[model samples]
Target: MTAYRDSGAPPAADTAGTRRPTVVVITDLIVLAKHLRLLDAAERRGVTPLFVFGPETPADELARHRRDPRHPLSRLADEGLRHVADTSLETLLRAVAPWLRERPVRAVLNVGEVFVEAAGVLAQTLGLPGPGAHAARVCRNKPLQRLAAPALAPRWTLLDPARTTAAGIRDAFSAFPAVLKPASRMSSSGVRAVAGPDDIPPLLPDYGLEELLLLEERIAGREFSVETLVRDGAVLWAGITAKDTNESGTSFFTETGHTSPAPDLTPAQEKLLLDANTEFLRAVRFGTGMSHAEFRLTAEDRVVLMEAAARPPGDAITRLWRLATGMDLDAALLDLALGTEPPTAPPRRRARQVYLDHPRGHLTDVTAEDVPVHWVAEQGRWPDLPPLAENAPARGHAVLVSRHRGDLLGELADSQGRSVSVVLDAPLGTGIDAAAHDATGRVTIHTAAPSPAATTEEPVG
Candidate 1:
């Protein structure tokens, strides 16, 4: 492993007109493809985006991205894509030294979950704004977040599946209607709600024995997530996102939909949720960066944190925020990273994204009956959305369908199981909930039941 050779000299300052300002972006190809808005924002700011890919990134995938003219990576500055031998802190720092050796970096930002800690370290080492190293580490692990901010977390306990069985844990702790979650997994994978002691045994065998899990008392209440942007230990902007999930009558807690600037929240309730989130950020010692923190507002008015991530909110929540508040979160994130003042605006409208469900079978076709729709059979392809209106609502819905013909439709076990999503924006005081429902209702998913012969006929000699 090579160590970074720091020259003990300050980073070169950008003289107003003489030097060009550049920001380093750390991400893999998959995330890069999904977030084209980042490139748009960088262009708007006249800031160059320098790219860095981890050593594990497949060369073929990188080449494919470069070949695509529309991909963000294709438009990088000359010699912009810096290569790192490995993601180790030492190697990463050494790899980017040549770029920062002359021009001072405005920011070192990470777009997805995979490289939070690395970006944090990079920002700190270069004297730029970022979530501190400690905060980044804490955000990646669920149990760590619980321990970091005990006051905000629900009653939770940890267990090592390799060392014990479901019955063993059930005997030790009998908290009914509790949630079982993997310590470090994302997207609701391996996350289940145990109704009672008996439910534990059935669910425990599905997880790898080597996994560490958390059992927590499920707080009964409305689900919501707080999207926060912070710099210098202070909140620059915060927005609440209302969440809908499949946990109502199901064992799995997959998120079904989300709405930004969560409508119908009273002043006191909004204050409570935002205040709790701020306290959690303070407790974690979050220095800078965007945080997507989820919470449950119980009937008794307690804001219990579900978890938090040190990155932009996923599942199109950022897009909804942009539509609702007329704020380009991607642009704002860049501004925050560069130490420039990020603009802010109160929510003038409500924007929502809802995922549609279908029966389990072989997929035949999915179509929109009347309303215009965007179908995505291929991965990493985004719809060309209309521009955000300055005053009125965007006045339309953007729908995305993920599956293609011949794809298998499975049970709704997690967030990944759902394939269709709808996004709509409306003027303030309008009940977007119904609009979302109506938009989804207009789409039809046609499926053919699986053939028994396919399942029964196995390879035989």
Candidate 2:
């Protein structure tokens, strides 16, 4: 999210040209991907990002990076974030010694979910505004969320993964069909909802119950992820995104395309949301920086706050901000962290980000009937995929982009018809192989588990 804030604005023009302050994005792949646009803006303004990563991140999992000659930015992984527990503070700081000394990194951006503790430490030493230990302890801890949420976002309560017991589940089973989630988990990775206490034990091992937990009171509402760039008492550039998640709705990352300019909220509600965001940050003393927050609006007109992250939105929500508003959020984030006035006007563009999803089928052999299809695993550009994987699912998506909002879906659906589906020799589900439909087909297929108990969600807008 901080990445897109840069837009086309030249790098900090007010700073020293020879050795401009650097923005250190402490991250893995997604963090780096989020910064691509900022890199472009930085290139125009004359700034280089010193991105660092850890080795624990798989190369395959890290979105593909190409050494294209034409590209202005160069990303080099330093495998530091992954080893937070082992690396000493001085040793870690010394790793980026060159950039720290040369560029004198003025602002430190914390995008890594697992590195909040490390980030807070870094920010304190560097004199930056981020989720320091006190802040992180308050935000990430399940116990804290339970205590604070009722007043801040009255509809919600914390769900402690550690203390959530069978008795606790039984007592609340009638009124609240509790959703069990890890207190520290960023996404829906370990979030699950069981109707009764009986379902609790089976989930302990996978949910990592070894740690403290958050047994949040399940709020019946429409889910929405809010992204805000807070500077001083104002939310400089704020945007709301529709989040599509996995079956558990717990995927830390979104898996489907997000439409910008979220529908359904009345002008009053929108203002309340924006105002509540600023006020909440004010309570936290969130003076400056990007913050990602998720909420659910109930059937009763109650607005809820789920989790408030003290940084920019992740996934491609960064792109959504750029598309919805003309504001360059990355630059705004840099400015905010550097104590400079971040701009409120979003950049002008109809931007959209779509995650390619396949039905519940194992990957089979996939091949494009046309020449080949390019996949955007990240914000940057990629030439084309080599070929569909051996088990790539038959029903998949091809994210498309266009300025015509009304015709965007039509265009995508049309372009989808251009590609011919290849036949697969595998079975369905895990065995589902690669196969393409005829020239006439939709560009993408969204998958949801087939459950008799599953309920459909009404469009919030």
Candidate 3:
């Protein structure tokens, strides 16, 4: 990764003096692909875009994009990329103010969780329509969500990891099973459940949670995320996604896959979820843009809001939405930021996405064969899969589509059950979950024995 220093000098003025509207994008390195989509969308709408990237951006990834002909970054304008050496709020504002003054900024946008606050601050500073810094802070901090919307949120308590000992947490959470997570983080990073005091300390070092944390009573039931587009403080479009995760022995909540248009939810159930989300968003004062809110449905059919972010959903959820509903959420988000109406067409198809995970070891070979259903995309090496933990990365992805809901669900179950049948020859014992989707429509993992050809050889770097 190349390090960037703060260039105190101001950006060169647009010599052509054309007053082309521009969108200021504040984001981090990990979400470059999403950034590329934003850039392409802006250009398609005849708007200029200036990307202010955090210093942590990977130089190698940028170089790869510049080399790939099909990548949008390959055609990025000369002044498209700028670096902010310091990501602090004050420093970011200082660096971005001058740039916005030079161009006619339509809106400030961000997809990554880390930069949402910056985008909100920029919009508020310039008096543009946005979620605002207060809303962004409420969305980013998990405990704040509970405090802001207590009636809709799960029971939670804030903890100072630097001061609170494990014994204190145990006493406070003795009545019920609880979840411990960082106050502000994404991708399930530093998120785990705690049965008692004994399980707390061991997991702290792994997450580096020596700061602020949120310990909430774990809501038991089906998990789902409601994706919404807000305009004038009202929800214009709402899409529900059913989530599947490794439910065997893993303490972490890493998603194994997701299906869109959640076939299992009845119209009434879906309405309840959406209504709760809308109320929560209102309580948080989310005035504009897109939101991805997670919730749990108890056996009594009650909805409990977990958390919500002031941005579009990641992990190809937008792609699934596009495939199912003919709604290009990426484009919609850009349009929303630019103060335009987005598409609100009903869904036409069902879509699903499954991620590949294996044991913790280097891989020698991998293959996908006899896949009964056609896949949208799949590519990755077995040796490169991240370990099963918080923020575990997906090794490969397979997207499936169907015209009917029942057929799509059946296809998803079959594909998930047989997904592990793919040959993954690795030295360590592979954790293959043969029955990933159960009859209840929940995503669970059932580990099976390793194949006979498996060897104990060391992995290659």
Candidate 4:
């Protein structure tokens, strides 16, 4: 094993020549589970994993992990983890240049949204293979993505919130039922649908003056996310995921469930989605790493692009893919970042993730039952449920797997009303509709009923 020093000094001479190729990971926060997977993958491939913490990272947190003998970070050589005062490209270059000179860096990667741009810039600056900073910038800016592939997206315009007036916006998009949202936000934050000029002003205060907003005609169709691995700008593998959202709520868009290997999609729809994704990747100049591209299939069979990111999809989609298919998406992404070929495999099973949401009020307890399929995992908070909006935080989540597609969906439907619910009259599965015509179709949970308890309760098996 190669031992690194924290004093900014190069590792001692590799007398035995046993040091493995090193890959640098830039992250804003330390997710222990994710890092453990990365470390194990690197070890299996005979590579060294070096973690670089950003300036904003809590030093005490890292110190605590470092001091614990059983923690993964403690297993690394003394110099395995390093912290810098600034995350700027120049600062990073100055900080890591000496270390790189000592040990050749195989790749530079980032999984956090905030550090995506930095990862690209550093990889390019260091003469490593990556999508480059331009692609990263396009991935972060949704409006720019639409512009890059206008033919694949709905009619849209980017507006400066400070200068754009409600009247001007209405005039520009006189069409009712247009969608307005921040140009560069995640988790559907600040997204809204407006019927006219009167509906625009009230939503403006929710956004910041400096934030760029995108106003566009909403496309009606089934929304799906295409997860692909690109090598040298060509897609090696593509998986489509069918999405379910809270459509009945007028306030915000909240995801309800997602089924992978979207069994319902026709062959033509799948082809269109994959083809459009390839074009979108090319337009964005994404060269390598995993790309998560979202799109909608209209009733008229039109394929409209929503946005693409040069990273793995969140919400445990990677785990879902691994269950449905024999592919380890996280490992594949790591391989791509390290300039190695990723393995490809076909789907062998079906997997679905359902997010349980309760009505707004004190959450007394959460429980799951009558799940007819193989249960994979469940996680969330309970008992102390905070006030929740239509897009409230998930009360809990469950992952189920099966060999048959029908069994998965059947189990989902069967577990609906009985599996998860709040004390209010609104049941978990009530009014939850999946539509082939619109991506925003959702199950609306009415929270008009009062809460019976003030304390939270652990999830019942």
Query: Predictions ranked by TM-score, top down?
Result: 1, 3, 4, 2
Candidate 3 at 240: error in angstroms? Answer: 0.5
How close is every model to the real structure, measured as TM-score?
0.86, 0.68, 0.77, 0.76
Q: What lDDT does the true structure give each of the candidates?
A: 0.77, 0.49, 0.63, 0.63
Best by lDDT: 1
Highest-scoring model, TM-score: 1
List runs of model 1 lying over 4 Å from the truth.
1-19, 53-62, 82-104, 362-365, 369-372, 375-379, 384-394, 403-406, 446-461
Superposed Cα RMSD, model 3: 10.2
List runs of model 2 lying over 4 Å from the truth: 1-20, 59-91, 97-103, 129-133, 153-165, 171-175, 245-257, 346-357, 360-373, 378-441, 444-461
Q: Rank the candidates by lDDT, best first.
A: 1, 4, 3, 2
Deviation in Å, model 1, residue 359 alpha carbon: 3.3
lDDT of 3 at 1: 23
Superposition TM-score, candidate 4 onto the true structure? 0.76
Q: Decide which is better by lDDT, 1 or 4.
A: 1
Model 3 spans with C-alpha error above 4 angstroms: 1-19, 207-210, 363-461
Question: If both were scored by TM-score, which would come out higher, candidate 1 or candidate 3?
Answer: 1
- Estimate, for each residue in 148-257, the C-alpha lDDT of model 3 and write its tens digit: 88888777777776567777876676645788888877777677878876777776665554667888888888889999988768788998988877644756676666
lDDT of 1 by residue, 1-461 (tens): 12422335444434565556788888765455556677778777877677877754566666666677865567654466665556667777766777787665688888877778778888887789888888988998999999988888888788776666667777777666799999888889999988766676667678888888889998999999999989888998899999999887888889988988887789999999999999989988998879999999998999999999998887778778877877777788888888876888888788888887776677666667555665543434465454366456435466676666677878778876877787877776767766666777777666777883442211100
Per-residue lDDT for 452 in model 3? Answer: 35
Among all windows of ten consecutive residues in candidate 2, which has the lowest summed lDDT? 402-411
Model 4 whole-model lDDT (C-alpha atoms): 0.63
